[model samples]
Target chain A: MDYYDIVMDSCSFPSGFEHALGFKRVFVSGRDFEPANTDKGEDAKGRLAIGHSSKNLLHAARRFAVAVVPMNLGLDRAFIETLRENSTILIIPLSVTYGASSDFALSTNMHLASKMLAYANKRKVRVGFATMARSFEHMESYMQLIELAKLIGASEDEARQGISLAGDLFGK
Target chain B: MKTKFRYVLVRSTTSLGTIDEHEFSKGLMHYIGATNYFKANPRVVKNIDGNSFIMKVSLSGYSALIVALALMKHVSGKECGFFTIYASGTLKALGKHIGTPGTETHSKSSNDVDNFANNNNI
Candidate 1:
């Protein structure tokens, strides 16, 4: 049985988890924020609070073989190294909020994808980029997806297929 | 070492409305002044084209983002405009100062800039 670890913001996990039970395991992750368990000193307010609290739902879903995905906002080398060590299938879901609407975000996503691809390729691991279902209506999201696919050296057909698969999997 | 910049001036060639280099310099300076990293005086020089010129401004390593953001803000929605940036060292130092990504030093040379520019496509 294959598990589809849906990487997303903490706020969006409940809905995704509800739909993802057919998979072997449903993993929920927070986007652009560290797991609360990992950071002790930081204040958890607003999004951070939500991200920290979302893990509570994971306990309820544990009977259904659901798991909380570990997330970290630290963009340092240590974070990348930790990712390499974990070696789990990494799913990065781009969100519509925050910096995603800007050109800077587009370029940053491409850069990040390339780096992840390089790391994963060397380790024989699989990494995927997912444009959140919420962002399907935005042209910039599609454009960023295409750009990310190209930067990660996915064939055009592969890129299209990946996006199509994601839409089918999560789109309302 | 003082850094020199080659720049092009863009304006409405047919319209009577005009802006002097001093005005441009002051506008850029005022924008930079809002940030904590930029402190040096900007030297503006006219290009061969009357409407275009280059302004040289010095800033600390941490101010690159400020410059990039300022440039992006300034050039947005303008026609006949061109801008380029060059950095002397790693972005990690700057990232550290800004309390962001501090450990990684990704390349920021012409190739990366070109890739970014080509991706953005004006």
Candidate 2:
């Protein structure tokens, strides 16, 4: 019954994250956008990293527990292999939902997410859903977040597990 | 003929005030599209507070409407978050959900629907 959320450190929720939102733990990170190729951070225990390139994606898979797919990802066999090897949790963040400025942007985000999700399904990659909120408006209720995972092509069961699975790796 | 509908409980940011219906429809149209908007045709049934409200929409358009509600990030130029708390088939049930713990308030026009239809309006 205890749900968890992963958000950017910049996100300011109301005083009680648990009482107000129902999330038992909320993981925070300022350097989630750190490139997968860099050694900028010493630890990747529960940190998120951007998989901007195929080369860096394979490398980032090993370095970060969660590789956030911020852009329209074009996955290859080798990338999937590397991600599976590292047991990396591919994250489909809510920033993609809130950041879409227009219908075009929304469709773009959904299309990319659908493709990523399909790959996750075919390859059995552990995926997570997070708010990654940049502002108060960027956050959503747990149900809404799960609905969003469905919006981007996750089934009812897949969406629920994806959200909780991401939390399992980071949340205490 | 009776028309089936769903009541949605929504919670927004504390700063958000009573939402103008037209502006709300316009913001939601961008996400659900004009056709789905007509299918959903959501109307504010009650304002629980500055941060929360109850809405009613046709049952057929429930899914698209929920997605639109979640996608709505700002309203009337103020940054806000709209969270759909609970959705139920009856206003009395929705009322109990928000903990008024009082008399059951059911709009006969919506419940029995009498002669009303989903497409009767312009």
Candidate 3:
């Protein structure tokens, strides 16, 4: 079965329904942030957006699941407690500052990955870490991936192999 | 005789690479003077390699012509003038690397076009 991973955009979910239904493994990105306004009830527009996105993802993937990665620094314990039983939530610790130096970005991403791994182990949640494209340079991105692997206790070679595998599965 | 509008596809790039699909269609509708615009079934596909994807888009209604013309100006950056109207569609995709391809069409109405263009600074 084909596996598909998508970076969730609040605006693009409606147009993505059909393709989501056909993939075997679906990864919903940016699941860490909850609706800004949660008091409108279950049928609220914000909740509905996420609900619809998640519903389509679940329907599409034969082994459907989600990974919640905190976007802003608002990663609260309460929010983590509300996730569905099967969800894998990753908690990032380092600050993400855009327009920063390459070294700074890599270090921040690595630090966050390590912290997230430790938190996952503590909580007994089977979790994995991912970083955004630090920069457009291939070498820079690859280096960041290496740092992430080291933090995760995977060898550099293992990390490279996994990325290649992911590329084969979902890279264009 | 009914006036026909035309659009010339423009290219855009992002951190990942070039943005293959036209991001907004409503902008085109206002440029051509369309009253109401609507999209047909739209399909987009990105390759597993994270390189590129194919998108098929279509538009209909009397206002569609105006939208098409605005699209051409936005993409090609050329002012509208008396020119032969080409009815061929547009196709574009994004990837790690960039490449150029033929054009595609988006359906949108006049109001939708104005809002989209103004919002995007097109």
Candidate 1 per-residue lDDT over residues B12-54, each given as its tens digit: 2211124444445544555345453244444542232242222
Per-residue C-alpha lDDT of model 3 across residues A1-172, encoded as one tens digit per residue: 2323323433123233213222222233345333321222223222211222333322222122233334442323433333334443332311232222364664465454555444544556543323322211101122233343444454556444433332232333
Find the 10 residues in a row with the least total lDDT in model 2 chain B: B100-109
Task: Choose the strongest candidate by lDDT.
Answer: 2
Candidates, DockQ: 0.02, 0.31, 0.02
| TM-scores of the models, in the order given | 0.29, 0.79, 0.28
Q: Candidate 1 docking category?
A: incorrect
lDDT of 2 by residue, A52-109 (tens): 4655555666665466444435556677776788877777776675578886887777
Model 1, chain B only, scores a TM-score of 0.35
By summed lDDT, the worst window of 10 consecutive residues in model 3 chain B runs over B78-87
- Quote the lDDT for A164 in model 1: 46
Q: What is the lDDT of candidate 3?
A: 0.31
Ranking of all candidate structures by their TM-score, best first? 2, 1, 3
Model 1: runs farther than 4 Å from truth? A1-81, A95-99, A133-148, A155-172, B1-122
* Local lDDT at B32 for model 1: 49
Q: Candidate 1, overall lDDT?
A: 0.34
For candidate 2, what is the DockQ-based docking class? acceptable
TM-score of chain A considered alone, across all candidate predictions: 0.40, 0.80, 0.38
User: DockQ winner among the candidates?
Assistant: 2
